[model samples]
Target: MKNIYILSIGKVYRKSNNLYFIDKDKNKRVIPIEGINAIYIMNKVSLTSNAIQMILNKGVPVHFFKEDSKIGTFYYLGSLLPKQKKPSGKVHIEQVKAYINVEKRSEIALEIVDAIRYNMIKVIEKYREVYDYTKTLRNLDVRKEFEQKMTDWKDATNVIRGIESNIWVIFYEALDKILKTYKLERRTRRPPKNEANTILSFSNALLYATVLNEIYKTHLDPTVGFLHEPYEKGRFSLVLDLAEPFKPIISCRILIWLINQGIVKPEYFKKDLMGVMLNENGKRVVIKEFESRIRETIKIKGKGRKSMLIFIRKQAYNLEKALVEDTKFKAFRLVY
Candidate 1:
């Protein structure tokens, strides 16, 4: 993924033939948009119409992130304009038909939830030796939830979310033992009240955005989802659904690794009227670490070993297979 990251307050415009990044200090940096997959605007960055046109002409998407959370995406006109956009092919059509049929939707939703549950259990079990999680592991009812079934999209979604909530509760509890500095009483969103919550939310948002980027490269529609309903507006519900199994297995591990490596300190966070958040330096550190984490290689069945980015794209392809060929979509499970 050839991604250009912009983190500072700057003005971006199209010069003679390249994109120029001019900082508040009037210092300019040239970024050739050639071979670039996406441009990530992480902070307050101004863009010119010509620059926008240049990006569209290159068929590159621009993703805007609010603070540390991803707000929305600006896909190229060719991607958004129905008349210009190509069909998603037969498999994607079948996937949409399944969405129209509630029974199939419920089945896929259950499979997604099942994958999420299995991964959560695997993550917790792997960390059991590192932390005394006997009580937490005993309280987790993975078997009962695995055997459970749902009737409709709403029911399946509710159960899936509820199970996910419980998993995080226990997962955070176990982490609190190792990461004593950043205490997570419970999972918090919007204004993350604590350092742990702030790190988790930011990195999780990155995970969501990465999934969306992969979906853009595939034939799958980012809006049409199973466990999550496709919102009429900008919400990428499919990314949210697919990102579930990955957040615990990837983002959580990266956060813990950062803490253990002393790369992240408590002073990196700040609290204001908006709530607790990573400072500028903190954002740089976390973003750097997150980027490195995605590039790290992992072993997979049949594919041998590959970087997490490729793994993500392959997972998206697996979903396409599941939708098109009526095959089971096996979510990634991190092996310790």
Candidate 2:
């Protein structure tokens, strides 16, 4: 698993042989080259030719952000994130073709919802004994009302909540027995103060945002998603579409794992005057764990293939293609 290294700690400068890390004030620090998947230069992080050569040889992509935080330069291994400045008009036409299959899109959207719901059922099944969820899903005339409900899924909270509650029930009996020490509970959208949910949401957004940004680099456009609604303000709903079933299993497991392993203790974070924020040491713990979890393998069903961290972006790209081509969209199911 590779890492998207955040040069947030300090100025990143290139040294001989490998990339060297330096602080803002002026202190040389050595960086471990083994774990980096990509490097993000959020600001004016510097690198030398020798250092660039080493990073390039390792096939690490380097990204530079402008003052406004818009992505400015993309450094592919030895090159940049890629500038398809002259995309073939024919390819562009094909991309459009993939994006505009109306009839196929409707079927794909339904299948994608089914797949997401199916995986969601697994999340529920983990907690409760299977009673008659088949009937519940069968009654879901969401298909007929998708056009409207997609706009206001806040109404569907009752349904999503029902499913979430069913999932928690199964764990309820076992959780208290196993997690007696950490005092665990099934958390919903908002996590309690002094808990790790803030870090999880922040990390998840960072992860999903990066993947969505990268998916755009491919021939696939970010619009025309199946599960999520397309609204204003550059809403990359497609990424969220893919991220739906993932949040509980991936991030939830990460939170539990970090707690059980003592990587992050309750003391690592504090509810400040503003809100819950991880202290310096706590940020390091979560940042590292989030990157590691991103790289962790989650067996994806239907594809019959094993996926790593980067495969997430690839899957999102595949979903975009599936949606555009009117093929059935297979949601990424996380096998626990």
Candidate 3:
């Protein structure tokens, strides 16, 4: 199945049980809903209720985005039980209970942090083979302190957030050494300052929405989370929690596009009151590369040469299994 992206100003509506895209120039195109699993509306687009109904009937989620920032998602209410017909609320109950208990929450936090740490280190090693990352990162004891302080009454989420911040610091520092013209000083949202940050913000949002779509095909509720506080309107925090480990995969691709391949040119970006943003061409380049990267095959322990997208859904299903069976949840680590 493929993802249908409405990237231009258009109106997408259902016609005789099929979806079509009509651009401002009156150029009409038919999108076969049979092979499409999700729709991403990136720009100004009007959707008829008939289109929404058709998407829901097909059980395909519609993700709306304003540029790189995600606005909302529309999917069926009963999309949680991918394999079972009835809703089993047991997994959600276990997830919330684990969040309430400090020890349980700390353990979950450690699992996430460990995965992030391992992948962060791997990314550095993969890019900068000449540098000694272990010696360079020896002074930053964020993970060690994170593990020790997680059990305290202090919020476990905040502790994990702190370690996440440190990991980015080490990550960007190593990245600076690799890249020639671009440098990432700190992470930025809303408006990305530089080219690298611009690509990162845009691609990370893609990853977030992708993971949320995958989570919908599982028994777990996306609203309830362990590392992030579950907000009523912000039900995607759990997807954010699950997105931590897979970041290096996207980050590696972004670096390759920006510095190695030199494919992302200056004209691909634009500056406005919102700082710097990817133009249509830039977004197309990033999305094309990012999608290709996710589809690339990698070896899983038991599952041989699985695509990264398949691994993400498998990880989500594994989390659901952990919640239901009361077993340890392990995040996905890059095979390299």
Model 2 per-residue lDDT tens digits across residues 145-246? 455444454444334334434444543333333332454444322333335545555455546545654554465555545445445345565566566556
lDDT of 3 by residue, 184-282 (tens): 666666567677777787778778777888887776788877777686463577888888888876755576456566777889988766567778888
lDDT of 3 at 334: 76
Highest TM-score: give the candidate number.
3
Worst 10 residues of 3 by lDDT: 72-81
TM-score on alpha carbons, each prediction: 0.81, 0.63, 0.85
- Those runs of model 2 whose alpha carbons end farther than 4 Å from true positions after fitting are 15-18, 24-37, 41-82, 85-108, 121-194, 259-263, 298-305, 320-326
**Candidate 1 — which pairs collide?**
none
**Global lDDT for candidate 2?**
0.52
